[model samples]
Target: MICVGKLLGVKRRLQDMTDALSDMEAGNGNRRILAVGNEPTADLSYKMNEIVTRYEEQLSGLRAADETNRRLMTSLSHDVRTPLTTLIGYLDAAHRGVVTGKEREEYLEIARHKAHDLKDYIDVLFDWFKLNSSEFALSIERAELAELTRNNLKDWIPIFEENHLDYEIEIPERPLFAKADPDGYARILNNLVQNVIAHSRATRIKIKMKQKEKEIEICVEDNGIGIEKADLPHIFERLYKCDKGRSDQGSGLGLSIVRQMVEKMDGRITVRSEPNRVTSFTICFPVKN
Candidate 1:
């Protein structure tokens, strides 16, 4: 019942409505008009404000999480370092003859051993921070595997003897060359052997290496109280402890560091266990022929 002129006006209004919606969708809102030259808009402004509010909230949450991590790292650094400094100082004093006799010798031995354990723990903590903060780079090169293993074994022989651990190091007569970082490979072996000595509580532990055409598999096996299935998956996680109460003799960082070091070498580490029967950590790394 509208006149032709009124119909044309209604059509124009429909066009304006379509244009406004299109402009909003395309984020070209300078063209949208709520009130012409004297423009004053409420609805559109409210929508934009709401979007900004949500974005700000999300950013705030991220910042808060970052701050919490910083605080945790700072506190951990302070707490762990203090006791370590004191332990090292006392051990040095005892070794330097500030104390003497069998009693002093025993105290010094305990101090030295515990200081080494504390050092291992701090190294793990710093490595954890690095692992989380940086991306891993595989800097591989050709190196003799047997020589590397021999040197590491020699370095740890004293510790093994001191702890009364019977270590059986099995290596091939001829050296096998592998592509990997010498330091990284050494750390992998050290962590595994250290775990065997510290947590395995086994009188005898073995390091067995298998060299194949494409990869090398090494395992540190022990006769010890094995890990539960539930604890296996979590053991590799950062700062996770499996023994409901931490093992009295260990820093709890050994296995975690082992996992990280294996991955850094482009290797895989897996554990197999039977409670009080045997526990073995197997690692495989690509070998350079």
Candidate 2:
């Protein structure tokens, strides 16, 4: 009679395991085999539970990736279509002689500007895609950061002057060596400065570099309508944008790209802003011997 009872218990546990596994296979991940206290199937149950947990985690990651892809598609549709439509409209008007003389010239000029804006947006989109691609790589080498920065800023001086913005640059004459991808580093600086020119409603901009005991710091400060305190923390998140009233010109990927590049190069970037007072973006790289 005791031997018969043991056989029945084993049979019952096996049936339960079979049912639970069937439920799990039918998309019920919550189904679990309960075996306790040295039961014949306890070891098998534990192993099965571990496998389910890992599978659940993988599914969760896939779901999240799908959601992100959906959001990206939606954003692309709206952002690209709106500007592209306007660009086509302007070009259509100019081509069909809808306006003539100085008005026509103005229309053409506006169309030209819109075309350039579309190109800029497309360029940013490409950069974002490239940066996120698995094949994307940086050629990091020990380079003189000061000279690279100075050379990059030289091109921006004319742009600052054209926008009627006063600028100050203070990169030390001495060479500061760091492990960096020169092109990637240049893009980081360009994005920050471009962000200021587009969004910051300030008249003065400053760029400075400092050498610390173990790190090199590059700072870009602007006396502008700074970011809202609430928005500061999310500035580096992908596709995040501040209040639309700030400016609608950006693709919202610039800072995200900057953060990725900085991290890839084994550096860090930070920002501080006080609304209506000042805004600053700082990048730090470990000093390379």
Task: Give Cα-based local distance difference scores for all models.
Answer: 0.71, 0.88
True lDDT of residue 234, candidate 2: 91
Candidate 2, superposed: residue stretches over 4 Å from native: 1-44
Query: Model 2: which ten-residue window has the lowest total lDDT?
Result: 243-252
Question: Which stretches in model 1 have alpha-carbon errors above 4 Å?
Answer: 1-101, 135-138, 244-252
TM-score of each: 0.67, 0.86
lDDT of 2 by residue, 111-137 (tens): 887787777678778889999799899
Best by TM-score: 2
lDDT of 1: 0.71
Candidate 1 least-lDDT 10 residues: 32-41
